[model samples]
Target: MTSIDRKAAADVIDFLHRHFPRGWKDWGRDRSVSCTMARKLLIALGHATRAERGAEPLDPPSSPGSLPRMDDTLLALLLVAERDYGFGQGAHRWIRRMKIRNDPLHRDLAASPDVFAFFMELGAVEDGAWTEPAIPALLRYHAALDPLPDFDAVPGLHAFRTNAINEIPEDVAAEMSDILEEERPSLWQLGMMDLLARRWRYPEGWLAASATGPHLLRIPQDALASWMAVELIRTSRAA
Candidate 1:
């Protein structure tokens, strides 16, 4: 690959690393890393495409309806990565392997170390501020990434922060509420109330408007507390 190609791939990889969770692959069966790898690859692809087209890098694609096209995102990512970044035939094969491993509706199948390295090389080229090649060839080197699955699909967890907010339709949101009520009441309620509060910007009075008889459920309370703790830990680490 040329100097430019390596730089672009490196930039893309760095972006993925920034978004990828720490010890991502080590989490529960290593599914976290796997899931993240796949999803982040999509994001990286979108970024590359936007870069090639001379448009702003798309952090996330926004839509007023359902989720954005993940498959298309992946395809675009691969094509652009290969074309502009010079990822090469070997890298392409590796990506194909990862894609085939992806369960889509079932499990997470994220990027491998080799893939990340390829992107990292491209990123370096994209930046042009650096003049050294950290990795000389893709023929001998490969990256080792882990699995980060869709936690929401996990049996016991229902609460999560997603990119699906801000454009959720009311009807779907209500249905989500009903599903949560049946399976995970407290979480469902928490999610619904949170969404409502955001949308309507209601006052503190809304918090006191619970219709389920003035008492809090233990599981829901714990979930809320856990979420808060996670945020605090993450914030502390960032700081």
Candidate 2:
């Protein structure tokens, strides 16, 4: 059996310690939690790959010519640094998603304004064709952080909203309008508008306003009717 590389393991632990100064408190005591964090970190660092069918035992380094391998015990210790620093699942996911290919270096994965902006643009798309599950997850992650990204600045958001309005039926559009008029718009409302706008194809000015404006309820009834007509014609064509 190949032995674990103690120096490589120590380096990983040291990296975590430097990144997170605090020692793992609540998260360190549980063996299971530590193991989970370690596995995720390994995946992010390209040291491990998740099995599609079921959990597989960590494989030893292929050969001396390949990268050094750490044992499960040392891997678990790496999580102590992660937990001590308050890095959560969200942070782990971010690192995994954004880690660059061809770059073996893995220590620097801090969130930034640019990363947040990219996530906002990702969430702006509502089309089933282009939608991503990660966008919603990232949005939820950012919701807990201060100084949220500006939705208006998200590229292609206007085009996404325009497309949604052009596809939905008139009745559905009316229902959406009613929902908006009756209550304050939340993320759901924003998403609905994005869909309705795909079919409605409202003017660029109006589309932009509706997206960033204070209230969807403030849109004039006549404008809403005009937008609704587009869906009606579309529905009739299919009939």
Off by over 4 Å in 2: 1-141, 181-239
Candidate 2, 1-239: lDDT as tens digits = 12235454445544444443442332223244444554444443334455553223335522222222222222233233234333322345334322211111112323233332332343312321213333321221221123433433445544544555465555565665565454443444443445333323222222332333111211111223333444434443355
Report the Cα lDDT for residue 19, model 1. Answer: 38
lDDT of 1: 0.32
List TM-score per model, in order: 0.21, 0.25
Worst 10 residues of 2 by lDDT: 213-222
RMSD for each of the candidates:
18.0, 18.0
- The per-residue C-alpha lDDT of model 1 at residue 26 equals 22
Please list the C-alpha lDDT of all candidates, in the order they appear.
0.32, 0.34
